[model samples]
Target chain A: MKEHATKAAAFIQDEARTNWHDESLWFVRSKRDKAAHGIPEWEQLRELASQIKDHTLSHLDEYLEAFEAKAKENGVTVHWAADAAEHNRIVHSILQEHNARRIVKSKSMLTEECGLNEYLEEQDMEVIDTDLGERIIQLKEEPPSHIVMPAIHLKKEEVGELFHQKLQTKKGATDPQYLTEAARQHLRQSFLQADAAITGVNFAIAETGGVVVCTNEGNADMGTHLAPLQIHCMGIEKILPKAEHLGVFTRLLARSATGQPSTIFTSHHHKAKEGGAMHIVIVDNGRTTQLGRPDFRNSLKCIRCGACMNTCPIYRRSGGHSYDSTVPGPIGSILTPGIDLKKYSGLPFASTLCGSCSDVCPVKIDIHEQLYKWRQIIAEEGHLPTAKKQSMVMAGKVLSRPGWYKMAGKSARWVTRWLPRPLIYNPLNTWGKARELPEAPKESFQEWYRKNRSAS
Target chain B: MSKAHILKAIQAAKPVPCPLPVVPVFEAETPPTREIFGSVAAQSGSRVVRAEDFVGLATAVRTIYPKDISIATPLRAIQSDIDLQQASPADLNGVDVAVIPAQLGVAENGAVWVTEADCVHRVLPFIAQHLVLVLPEDRIVRNMHEAYAQIKIDDTGFGVFIAGPSKTADIEQSLVIGAQGARSLTIILI
Candidate 1:
């Protein structure tokens, strides 16, 4: 896969679209601020939520066992998948047991991570994504750019064109309401016809053996309630110790995600419905390995709220597809390195280290700090790009020696000021590609400081 | 095999023990007043009506949908086209309107708690074209914290906190109501 910068360069080619994407995400960030400001205990909620997740993760094994036992007692068949392939296989086996051919799934990023749809397609079972945002990307054969707003990268005109081609809507129609209705009518039929439904878990309460799935469109409910067989996929890190923790998370989630006080529906399922079978697939898929890293373990605290993505300056500008991971943006940068360092080594550098993401995170995952930490680990593991490695090594050597550093600094300042633009900002200068080089002054800061303040 | 592998990994990776913290108690003001709840629910894309009695709720429902062909309700006093007891969940696919009773209401987000016992079919509240949730005036709570305290998860296999009609902003950040579920929500406060 191409590096994040390469994809981001291509994505930002259209200045108008880039600005629209940036502003669109900023609008959500401002809404989040407003929502957060509305609650008197918002900071308290963040702290408490962080604490709860921290405690649960410390005792993750106990909670997972408790959650599994309770869920089994509630008549749910709980399956644990150590990886994505096992998860896919477990879901397929369930469908095969039920003789279910048509599958309707709501927004489950875990399933997307597992490549469940592709796996099912290979197995000759028809799969339909029911979430409006998910359905748009599913039709386009693209991965979701934004977690909450999956189709945020596409313009209405593009969506209209895609719908016109796929659903045969009016060729020139760009109205969201009209296009949404077309999806509604089309997916409703699939919901009715689907023999099985699959959804993602938002919170799995270990104490009560229940899973909560929140959605604004109620697609998860519509699909699961209609289908006789239901499968819910959850990462192991999703477990919470108690149901009361939901009050804290539910309050913060939608507010952080899209500024809604709450999602339209927070459906709690403790057991399989009457005469129907339910399956819960607990997926590890690098979570346990992530948990072992003390510095990076906090990344598991993410509730997948996508607040970090919205608040990230780089993410808003570069777009989600730039990261080229199942989850993207700041959280993905810190996470993907743990999963596959070599393949995703460039992701850690795709940030400005603004710390906006950490400030906005509901669970208070120190996202920016983790991103910085990942960069160091990537370099140590010999996974960094050659240019970055060479530059860092050269800079390190120069900075460690005071005499050489001063000489190099003075020489660089002289070179920057006297050298021609072509000579100074050539192929080796990656920083000057999208930005102008700063004007160098005649005297260095150290020189001026000594002259002014050394005797004072 | 994956289950054992995962559990073993989790056990081995377990961190230093940290006891679960007690959830901080939030002592806010009382739940929203009838007027406040009405406005909040309205902002969430739902119509809220102060219905003094069952008859008043029926009147509001009729006013909301004057010419609808089919209406399903579990309420005994309210007359409707389909009785939830007799209708299959799949059969409620295109129901024009459904008047179901909500167990409780959360004022913070204008969400009403509805359990499976209240909804005859698990799909009744969602499959209906327009959903009318009849919430009693006394059942409203100040926030989700209080709402969670009062409800019992084990009492029902399925339950939901429905704040408004189904909605989405997926198509270029436009708020489009009724994406794949109820197009409108009417909370008739009794």
Candidate 2:
């Protein structure tokens, strides 16, 4: 019940548009469709990929062990963390060992989930976020709105203001190119001065003992090359069996997430630049419990592609802050429950059950299906209010018995017809401010169907 | 050091044996692509050509750089082909064109991936005033998934995916292409 997150949620709830957010996310999802549909073997490739991921998740312990062995041989030190606090401690210790005062980190949502930046900032270590969008939000000292485009909520003017305040650009100059150049120069100096670099693992190859970090702006390379030590933080689930699998994911990842053919994919191999050291920490905050559950295990196969987020109607409208987790959206709804159910009771109820997220998933993860399962889990745990359960039970009984259903349906139409649109909408829904609700007719569709059936 | 002594010293150096995965034979028969590749195109000012034969290849090469100008090739290529000679300091500074082979190509980013094999000292491309990449059209892939699908572990001794000739947005986000690499590229699709 952190008030900081609640304040963030309130801000997002005020700004999120059902239509625009859904459309924007769907637009990217469709770009993935176009890229994937053009390839006739796309379905087969997805099947192969799903199979590979499924196999890997089932044998994750074996592969992780194999990765640990191979990574050791490659001169990469391995660390394991059972929880976020342990993960943060291990990372901080590594930085301390390097005598690192200043550190540069790319967009690792895992670190964000762990609140590592806040933790380190508390310890008086300056952590600079290098990803352009991440940096924008970082400058503003706010949580990222979206995983891919962290600062998508902010416009260029807002970014200019943030940069002007943080980097101290000349007053009244807010050009994007100029701003980006300033950031590049400023970050370049930071990169050179940084003693260590931290990166999010895009893919961890067990066969090659390497980690792939896909970035569009080359920020990861800038920091990694300049720093003497490179530390990669990944969820235990990111492990892939071999280097060859990088293709299956790299092809589907960016197109699904951002409509790009691929993220400018960069893989770091061996140790950090000759004598430089590399450390990888594998973390399982709640993954073991997730792994034990067959129904929710497939959710772990996510490549961190934002496809589900983009396609989710509720997510687009309510915004990610409403989900109130390291990850958000339909995937987040199910994932949050696994990580912490009581705190995330409202998440499973957030979706419209549209199923577009599952349709657009490159790996064919049944996202909406998991949302449905999470609903059962939540209800079973008595997370739902007693009044809601009673009302739902009454409604279920009335619907199952066709006589009461017809009466209820007729009453619902009659009530909706009398209720003013404004009363039902802006004050309550609030979605109407940005998105329009469909106008319901005077008569119900079921009544029309009933009349037509009798006439035929 | 003489070649014999160097060979003896190389044998005397300790070999650090690490776990190497067995590379499975992958049959990569790339299909013809109509999508434009950026590295090859941007290198040659986004040049597109239709050449089905060797004569067409030569015509395309000569079209970019004249025949009187000697194109710089690698040390091994110079010894094998009499047409190319060992490039000197003058060639490094004055050579107008250099034709090099690429290790891979990614359609995902419109990148033609070349490596140190073509770079020699990472400067062979930079030092040359003008450049030409011998990108076989069939090497193009739609994304990195396909680009990485065909790789063997040993080939990364040194390699890079040259998306386009080195360009930088360092100076006020103005795209000044060919900052450190070749100022101009003429891609000969072989």
Candidate 3:
């Protein structure tokens, strides 16, 4: 995978688009603040959510069995997949059993992580993403940029252009309403004809053997309710002990995501509708491994609200696609490292260590702290870039010895003053390329302190 | 075999037990009002209409949508172009408006509790271009906590808390009223 910084540089090449993306996410962050402030027990609710997740994750084995048994009693077929490949095979086999050639699906990052679409296409099944944003990116043949808003990085004109090419919409039409209406009319046909629908579970109630899927577009419900067969794909971490827990999460989810009171639709599916078959695929896919890591397992507490992404300075500017992970931003940085430490080592360094992401997070994942921890692990495991490792090692040696450090500091100031512009701002100096180095001080802090304090 | 392997991994890696925190109860200071419901619903791109009874709902829905539009309903008095009971979920794709009953309404978010029993097809409320819900005025609750306390999940196989019209701000964070579901939502409060 390409380093995040390399991809971010490409994303930031268009200066205007970067600013638009940043400001747009910041606007959502502000709306989240307003929605959160309106509720007096917002912080308490967040803490409760965190605690509930902690409790459930601690007893995951028991709850998983409980949830599966209950779902089976409700006449739902529950399947377990050890990995992404197995998950894809199971879903494809189910579709094959029903002779389903065409399928409509809502936004499920789990499907993206599993590469389900590609797997299904190879099996000669057509998968149409029904969420408008998801559809926009899918038509463009790209992964979703943001978890909540899939096509958030794209401009209206780009979407209009994409629609022109794919859907044959009127040329030069960029209005979201007009574009959305076109998508609706187009996807409506897919929904009506598709043999099955698949959705992502927001929360799986262990008590009732049911699942809740929240969506602003109501795309999940529309597709699932229309199709003859419905399937919900959920990671093992999505379970909650009781149905009453919906009150806490439902209030926090949309408000933290897009800053609404709630998503337009929070559909609870207890069983399959009349004659339809409802299936639940609970996939492990490295989650069990993640739970084993004491420091990073809290990462599983994420509700996929995208609050961390909205609040992340680097993510807002660099764009979500830069991380090169299914779920991007701070959460992805923590998550991706555990799954593939060598490939995603650069992700942890992509942040400013601002801790804003943690504060804004509904489940309160210590994102910046985990990023710091990952950096140390990456360095220790020799996963860090060679240049970074070498420089850090050299700096560590110099900083360890006081006399050498002072001499080095003095030489650094001397070199900055005497060296030519081209010599000082070379390719090796990564910080100097985009920004100028700070002017060398007349005296080091030690020198100034010694002179002032000794005489007094 | 996969289940056992996965569960074994989880059991081995599991952290020490942390008890679930006591959920705090949030009491709304202000009583539920029709105005609060209307404004909150409006914030989510849904309109709230006050009607005296079922007969008035027909007039209200007609005023908002043209007569040529295909209106579907499970309600008795509302004049509808399509009978939802007779139409399959997929067949209701072209429906312009669907009038359904809501079990209760929450004032804080303008969410209305809708169950499968209230809908002829589970997709009726979502598939329509526009939706109208007839909720009794007295059924409005203060917040979601109250609504959940009153909800019986076992009785209905399916249910949803619909807050507003289907929406998305995905494209450059521009607010789009309609995405894949109903373009608009109208709640007829009687």
Best model per DockQ: 1
lDDT string for model 3 (B1-190, tens) is 7889889989999999999776655877788888998899998888888876435877888887866378888888887688666777777888888899999999999999999999978999888888889899999988887888888765688999999988887777788887888888889988
Candidate 1 per-residue C-alpha lDDT over B1-190 given as tens digits, one digit per residue, 9 for 90 to 100: 8878888898888789877778865867764577767777889999887786435877888887888768888888788787676777888976899989998888788899999999889999999999999899989888888889989866799999999999999988899999888999988888
In model 3, pairs of residues that clash are none
lDDT of 1 by residue, A265-362 (tens): 99999978888999999999999999999999999999988999998999999999999998999999998999999999999999999899999999
For model 1 the local lDDT of residue A29 reads 93
Ranking by TM-score: 1, 3, 2
Comparing 1 and 3 by lDDT, which wins?
1
Pick the winner on lDDT between candidates 2 and 3: 3
- TM-score winner between 2 and 3, please give it: 3
Q: Model 1: runs farther than 4 Å from truth? A: A449-456, B53-55
lDDT of 2: 0.67
* TM-scores of chain A across candidates: 0.98, 0.88, 0.99
Judged by DockQ cut-offs, the docking class of candidate 2 is incorrect
* Candidate 1: Cα lDDT at A110: 93
Q: How large is the i-RMS for each model, in angstroms?
A: 0.9, 13.7, 1.0
